[model samples]
Target: MGQICPSTASPLCVGHRHLRHSLLSHGRSKAPTEFPDLSFLPPEMAISILSHLSATELCLAGCVNEYWQELADSELLWKGLCYSDWGNIDSFLPDGMVPIQSYKRLYLLMDDGSSLFNGDSVSGLEFLLNNGVVGPSDRHIGCFLHESRRLHADKVLRLLQDRRGVLDELVGLLDFHDVFLPDALRKFFTEVPAPKVRGDFLEHLLTKFSRRYFECNRDMGLPQDTTYVLCYSLIMLSVDLGSPHVKNKMTKREFIRNLRGAVQGTPGDYLVNLYDNIYLHGHVAKKSHYKVYNNADF
Candidate 1:
């Protein structure tokens, strides 16, 4: 008669008990093992090491095992990201969240709620600070207008009267890393106090986007017209921020002069060159090929 080993089908024939320990040892060695001695590190050390990973990478780390999962979702780790990325979270704390708040949900709110697909259309001031506004698209133009109607008088006036409204500037949408959008927008939006007039908003945008462009994308070889597209859009939007003067229609010549003025006023040397190149090197109205954009294009 023989008995089976607990983990194996091999029979322990009569008087073969001495072989059992060796068999058990061999079977146990086959179990999976994680990285050696990781758990030995103190929690603070662990948090410091793991904090360098981006949010996406942190999520992958959490799947390794339960202990690693806890470390990945550690409040200390996300707190660092929240402060580092979005600045002090105290300002964003909602009313109901009394003693504490979920940094993860707050992160999602900033990240997800900013996208065109996910967020509600908030006021220009709030939207700029939150990084929740998207640049205009065919469908988005109407949506932006709709949002304008929903707000209070101050916010609505700020939107329409500010020269750097959704129409006037793309804000940080083009130049910044989307992850840093919330913080970047907040810092820059706060740099200048609420602007009472439209031109001030345009000036802020020209200054800000130009500086950011020079800093980040200066070396990038953007096409002449592509560069012109940005210049034209900003210039046109600024000049046409409010209702176009019905008394005297905005003519093509007036628009071009406005472009020149905006280009001259912008801070970057390269931006000035791009504007010059577009106006001089290429015939903007070559052979009467100038395409007219109606109000809808704006």
Candidate 2:
């Protein structure tokens, strides 16, 4: 036999591996065999469905074939992915170019550990130093950060208000090393337990968040926040489940179960989205995906 082709050889091998994968994952083992032709679907409709997919899905979709790759990597699709992942990137961009240009590169670079994974967190400290957007967050921050090794607790103790309370709260989260999660870190960890939010709590949350400058917007409205929350399924979407980039292939639905439990251990009608943390209100609710007309509608 000729030299056996190793799957790990080169770029060409990578492409072949993807080709082999596409056949199995999507439909058949043989390319020319009779099978369902998904490519015949209108491109716009296809891309829209693809848009509802996570960042990793769109990348994997690109590997399926040339036409699919072109559609998957289109500027329009990647733009939505960029905004969904990082809100706004103006601060992260170089001068003299608009957002999508940075987004094009961002799609490739987001996986780089050095960009976000290695930051020293000046922004969180700045918020605390500002006495926080609503001032009451001072207590919250202090309680959350006092003994935090990540906070350089000695330095934060001098700069922050409510030093006593922060220290008291900080004791619960502290450890000897920088590796331990602070109270702030604990909130984002889906596996960690959190207090259950009560019934009709979304309204209370919206109202509470609206008062804070950090939570609401320049217009001081909750509509944008509310809509985004419903669309992205809140903190549930921020996680990486079954990430093509990772060794494990857990689904996004499984991922959101962790977030939902962390956010509120018990559930309510408004919070349930059986759709794998994608669009909670998109197709099933028969609701328009456009703007929120009434402020109270959410």
Candidate 3:
């Protein structure tokens, strides 16, 4: 009879090791199941899908891989995001002025500006003024004005005007509309002492008014000083609207005529838009959209 092998050196142990090796080899032979490759999709389709992502999400998606990074950095995606959040770029900025060359850079700048201004940090004002030195293009100024609309527009303008060369630096880069319109709107409402406006409506009106103001300033070729006076005229118009002593509703034609006289330039389209926004849209109410509008509406 043959002797039995010890348990440690048994043929059964050898068989078990062979089985384990076979299983391991089998597992290794099969390919890994990966997630669907976004890169496999058409570029347009991928962008369309990415468009659903918020600015923050889009930025995060870029971190996944190089393929995603390429698509995530797309100009179209960033540009759409910009328009969605801030509306027409030309409306917020001067005509034909591309503040940052890339939409991605502009979006980042705007986002950073919004966060910095809205955040609790005290450095926002200093950063924005950049110590009265020449800053970036008017695009940056537009971003500053648009983002900081939550702050007192008059106060911001006053601060800028008080700082030597800051306002001039802004004016030199692009037309002063980026700063002027928002500041003027606030100044107007303050002087009128109209009813306080809701925050939402004030933001809307500021954007709309700024867009119209920009168009007017562009068409008339008005100098910076003239634009400044024109902003003052807008304040006077607000006074006329709010004053019960005036009694008569000023006609659109009359409003434009008055603005022209005050600024000594044709601000017809702008004044008409302004008059319609206030008179037709019921911007001026007994409760007075005045106070909030002063801080917000451009």
Candidate 4:
């Protein structure tokens, strides 16, 4: 055979070249595509981007990875959300009460629906009540009372004392058919306010709210006893609705039985009607004969 050309040298050389080519091709095909890393972004830019996300969206973003978690849990972000949902946090906090957790935790607590009912026990309630920039209104106060059903009387007293027009708001809570005045009162008096203040407040509540109910349902043939004890009846109904010892869902008999002792001499039919109306509508039924009383009458 003619002398082997150097280019065709040995079978091993050809095999080596083929193996090298295969390795290069495989490396090129298997290479991972590069992606832009959010971690490389400036923290301020990252926070600014995350600021647009809602509380729920931010929570989901936090689960993505470590870097995003840091940005998602930023106090600024949460504080902003808290401010948006509930104005200045400091305005609502009781004089001596301080938050026990991060703004993030506080926001989450407020975001939870159950927190509205658990205010008495949850420490987060300290920051949950928000009076807004201008301050708390009757509607806001009523809502606060409704949400803070279990809040301590002392704390509620402090909150109310600091605010103007609280008595009017407290009465307004009753005027609206939707508010559970009994539970609201129970929450405010869990520990009881000063004797004079308590007396005046209850008197106002009884005079205004009870009289309104009476005026609204004057044509219903309600017993005078029902009218006289309507405020007391509301208190008893609150106990029935809130007391852990009693069944949550009460029958007509159970409802009447619970209130009959307090509202003695009121007919069962009247009591049942009152209970159904108050429980279902937060006030007695208003008939066509209902008359609007002047504020002076209260």
Candidate 5:
């Protein structure tokens, strides 16, 4: 003030402005007075944050803490995703979501329950029915059937036979199922009536049914030809789905019994021989005169 120094006064004013800004920033860094303590945040809020993450991220976070691993593996989370993602669709199968561990836990109910996404009791059944090689999509129904061939062969063979009239539309699916057929490609091209009909339909149905027959009859010691006839006849009978077809309710046990008897095995309600597919074409029925159980059964 004695010197009346303009430079000094200006420097002081600038320093004051800088100090004000630094103080403001420090004040902002502090929590608002109304803010709750972060350390005391509710567990629900924490879970919600974690739930927003992707599957890979969730998996990674699981490794970060034991609590996270428990939450991540909770079936509720996966089932919620399944229901939210595809449960509303007409063709959604909860079992289709089995790749997710949580959904797998609910798979049995999803498949059999009435509150299904499709409003149908059979979970994936609608999806399998509507989509096929004919559907514009990639048609995964065939893949599903192929996976069930061992346990559900009778069911699948019957389903395809019912749809044989539309076999042309099921090309891709038939190809997939045919993979289970030993030497399937060769048999379809060289020895089967498949060339005349839709090759895919015959290929799929025959391969699957034939495999089942072989597994159930090999040890019965039936001549090779008798076994082939048995398998083929069973395929034809189940698929007919006609008024007179064996459409009456028959459990797997009952069907197996009748099938074994038809093949000249012990007259019981289950397969007696239990063979494999290695000898499919090696033998042939000498008479081919086995009674057609029911032409309407197809």
Candidate 6:
């Protein structure tokens, strides 16, 4: 019986057959299962990943979702427009550009107007005045200049000139002349063409602007007389632009009249004489206060 058991250890024995079956079953159990399905992540996490894309990329991605379309079109997202340099706003256009030209025109007009206001010298004023020889169509920009000490009155005329050189009184003048005039005077003034009067007036004003008449005047060896020039210039401007209502609105008349009164007391004898000739006589001394005016306003 022991001899029979020994023989079963050979390759063809039933014990050997059982061992083969066990090995086969163990190998099948160890085989790798298919990889776990990983496609069901949260939608919020996916959106968070996509939020940091650039403007163009965001634009394209917007086609994929309503929220993205709105975010992409936001003005805050337009870094190109927001960070644009003085005249460089034109460079941000895409290949099929049409709106770019509109943006450029607006920006250039605004820049030209602003330069005259913030500029520290006659150079900027002259440049802006020259540009104004052509019209600036942006009404908001024009209105902005109206409120700021940005440009000399002459420069404002130049801009009107450039706008097709239309001679218009109401276009440039900021007041109602009739209100300030007697009825007879108002009738005479109304008979004149506004454009012709404005054109003629502009020419005369330019001569004063050319002479730098309203500049500080202090450095022309007459520092003590400088303030008079400024005071007179301010009053003259107020008179030219102000209506009778404005003059009537003068709680500040004492201040203005006092300065006008002191015009005679200024240290420079020649300058005092000059102010009388110009302010009262409507004539001006031919002197350039470009540097002086620039310093005061700037």
Query: Which candidate ranks first by TM-score, i.e. highest?
Result: 3
RMSD of each: 16.3, 20.1, 16.4, 17.2, 20.1, 25.7
Worst 10 residues of 1 by lDDT: 287-296
Q: What is the per-residue lDDT of model 4 for residues 1-298, given as tens digits with 9 covering 90 to 100? A: 8643367566555544554555565567585344234465557767888899988899998998999999998999998887776555554444555453588876766566224423532333333444121123444554444333234444454445454365446544343233333433333333223222224555544554555455445655544345546655554564465446877656667777777776676677656665665566432211111111101111
Residue-pair clash count for candidate 4: 0
The stretch of ten residues in a row with the least summed lDDT in candidate 2 is 289-298
In model 1, where do residues sit more than 4 Å from their true spots? 1-37, 95-97, 116-298
Local lDDT at 241 for model 3: 71
Clashing pairs in model 2, backbone N/Cα/C closer than 3 A:
142-166, 143-166
Q: Could you estimate the TM-score for every candidate?
A: 0.34, 0.30, 0.38, 0.34, 0.25, 0.21
Off by over 4 Å in 4: 1-66, 73-151, 158-164, 173-200, 211-228, 233-268, 272-298
Candidate 2 backbone overlaps, count: 2
User: Comparing 1 and 6 by lDDT, which wins?
Assistant: 1
Q: Is candidate 3 or candidate 4 better by lDDT?
A: 3
Clashing pairs in 1: 163-198
lDDT of 5 by residue, 79-122 (tens): 55545433432233324443433453443333433123224213
Ranking by TM-score: 3, 1, 4, 2, 5, 6
TM-score (C-alpha) between model 3 and the true structure = 0.38
State the weakest 10-residue window (summed lDDT) of model 5: 286-295
Candidate 5's TM-score reads: 0.25
**Number of the predicted model whose lDDT against the real structure is largest:** 3
lDDT of 2 by residue, 90-158 (tens): 433333444254444555554332122224324444433342211243344433333122223223323
* Candidate 2, superposed: residue stretches over 4 Å from native: 1-36, 91-99, 113-298
Off by over 4 Å in 5: 1-110, 113-124, 127-140, 147-151, 165-182, 185-298
Candidate 3 Cα outliers beyond 4 Å, as residue runs:
1-40, 60-70, 73-110, 119-122, 125-161, 169-237, 243-298
Q: Each prediction's Cα lDDT score?
A: 0.44, 0.39, 0.53, 0.51, 0.39, 0.36
